[model samples]
Target chain A: MQITTFSFKRLLIYPVILIILLVLGFTVTAEKQPAWFQQAQDEAEQDGYKLITAHEMKALYESGENFTIIDVRPEYEFREGHILHANSLEFDLGDKLELKSDKQAALIGLLGSDKKQTIIFYCRSVA
Target chain B: MGYQNVLRFPDGFFGWKSFFSDNTQSVDTIKKLGIGDVFPSCRLVMLYDETDRAYLKIQSLQKSFALEDIGNPYLYIVIYNEKCLACVDEVQSFKALYKSLNESLYLSDKVKLLAIGAGSKKRGVIAFKKENAIPYPLFADENRSIFYCLGNPVLPTSYLVHIQPDGRRQILFVQQDHINNVEMLIQKIYSLVKDMELPK
Candidate 1:
């Protein structure tokens, strides 16, 4: 009887150890998010910019909604390819929405004094 | 800045192109270059000098070189975009590999490193070369001719080609994405080419 009891306990402990090891392996192999990713999330929240996916953007484009889409990549990249009806406005690296005086004027010109206009800005990636 | 209902498309052009079917002819649409494929012949304009400085226009730097002209036993072609920050960041890893090759007595003379800036103009290429202090030869593919010829690969694609004495060439290895570890890659290439005869 004692032998059977010990055998049962051993089986239970084996599974328990296996489960612990699996969990540890997963934790070790899990990819850690980059620092910039978290910072971008925080900035988006603080700046009140809504993040939309490609599908959502497609839906918005197909819905014919009265919205302005701007391609904020470099001129060459914009020339290479961009979404339909998206205006070109190049932004330097890491200069999200920080437009210079002339660029600000250009943005104002594209936006046309309407504070309620639905505007969207996109670049090479979310970064 | 005062727009209240502003939305941001995080996926940008690449994601949009991938999801939707539009008139935009993106480079990603083309098939990626893979192993067992012959490297395409394209003209590459040299933009940077040996000292890593941008060559002035008056320096008469309009000369271009063909891929077939580089007579090295092994050629490491790194295709990158100067405007792409991620691509620029990946250059450090290539630099490490270059340093390793230079340090290796056997591979130093046999391997040649070359960088092609896809969709990159001379000015941007110069600035990128200067900023990174890249020691390798930098070429600008402003019109993306070479990029298109190579199947419009994703930014930071590297191809390792083995050239034979009879002018036959074949891609030996390809790294289509960021290389996380240089040491492992060095060891891998070393093991692959350790027994190969050096070019005469």
Candidate 2:
């Protein structure tokens, strides 16, 4: 009986070991990919979007061009000083995660959940 | 909408020029601090975050290197620890630049190193702690008067200025990143001094 119990415990070990290895492998792979924002240009390729500077926004505004302006700063900072009519779409710094569900929903409502639009993220500085 | 060629400001008004309006200091305020002149008695200030590691590194440098009697000649070191969210290697690398500058410049009491904390996510301490940091005096400037005074808000930077005999100051050099060689900083200081007709 002791032998059978010992054999059962051993039988569960390999699967657990395999599971650990897979989880670790995936996480390590993610870390190697660099931060999310650094991948902006690459993500831009996946979906046609562009990263712009604060000065670029000024020029576009003066030109009267219609491009979506997403303000990725915090709500307080957004309120303190930001471009007029700029939709606040705060994302994580390294592909920052949106903190508020309402904010996230508002972003979807404004930009449309549609994956394609001329989305330009601008804040005090590009992370 | 009309489109303009999008590259370079073409030497027109931009961010660099905007910093000038802060009205912190004027060129005519002093005789333009020159080389061979004693370092100014300006106080050191920082807008450092209490929890930042890089800020701590710089603080450590200040504590370790602060000298009351380097005596006859000196420059002040002010570190702006405002937005110090850099990687460990990036922070560690600054020490190398500091050492290089110190070794090459024949830096005596004539040069002072000052760092300004540039950006911050929080109210007080926008800067962070990093791997290794410079050895020198550091000062804080929350409103960025010095930054606007000198107009070099670029991050991870250092500047050299000549404090003229008559107390006027002129910027001799400004370095944005490790890309700037320290030896060049020395050369600029020497030139600014020579131009000011001061003894090198």
Candidate 3:
């Protein structure tokens, strides 16, 4: 059987085309972030959620200020080490912070549990 | 749902360790730390090479990899991690101070320096050290056992430890939080060490 150079070159075209398509697809997907991200941030802002730094939080804790700290990290991470007196809740699935339908009610219940309390959500690092 | 107020601790647990001391040592602990107060030393994990790793047994301002190994006595120990942005700057400043003071008393053999990266994996810290071009030997404490052992407190804490001729370990000075000026810090450390040597 004679394997021509032209035939070998033709065989390589399939992989080349596949690689180009894969790169283009990856670029398109990478450039676009999750649709729910901006919506969530807007919702949080509309709900009067304010951002605070760790140093400020430390000062508040030192002064004996009353505040509810919600740890949004995983249960295992919370168990490992979390802020003192902070409550833990897993608000993530895989990589997305999707508010699953079942968990929504529990979240609402938590928010409504304390009417006069100030609630703050905290994670390892804010991004 | 709307909430009244919300705040986040950006620095988190690591930052908290830098700001406050554990039950053993409170915020006022610094004032109480003098010649007689013994500095607790523990064995901490450190990354030396790609494959070879060992536990750094730090006790009385001395460091050793193995129990039978001879501990290298250092004049000071700087505990930091890659997570702390300020620590990066602090390390750079230390390098600058070290170079600038090469011919001075501050950078003499009498003042041996050792840096330890607390609570970070070896891989991450290695990259950090490489990028920073850190002149001093860097160690990684993958497990925060050393932090807890030292009683969790603020990070980037520098201890000026002195091993007297009589083999007594005493802390001459302790600097907490981010240091902006390395020269000033070196001066301060020198003055503190000199004060310790002064007769009462």
Best by lDDT: 1
Candidate 1: regions farther than 4 A off: A1-36, A42-127, B9-28, B46-63, B191-200
List model 1 lDDT by residue over B104-134, tens digit each: 8977877777888887788878888889988
Show model 2 residue runs off by greater than 4 Å: A1-65, A70-117, A122-127, B1-42, B45-94, B119-134, B148-157, B165-168, B176-180, B190-200
Against the true structure, whose TM-score is highest? 1
Off by over 4 Å in 3: A1-49, A52-68, A71-127, B1-36, B42-74, B100-103, B196-200
What's the TM for chain B in candidate 1? 0.77
Candidate 1 vs candidate 3, TM-score winner? 1
- Model 3 residue B127 lDDT score: 88
The CA lDDT at B61 in model 3 is 37
Q: List the residue pairs that clash in candidate 1.
A: none
Sort order, TM-score high to low: 1, 3, 2
What's the CA error at residue B11 for candidate 2, in Å?
17
Candidate 3 CAPRI grade = incorrect
Per-residue CA lDDT of model 2 for B1-200, tens digit only, reads 11222122111122213422231122223232233333333433334323222423334434222223222122323334433332222444455545654565454335544444433322333224322343532344555544444433434445455554455444455455444453565566556445555545
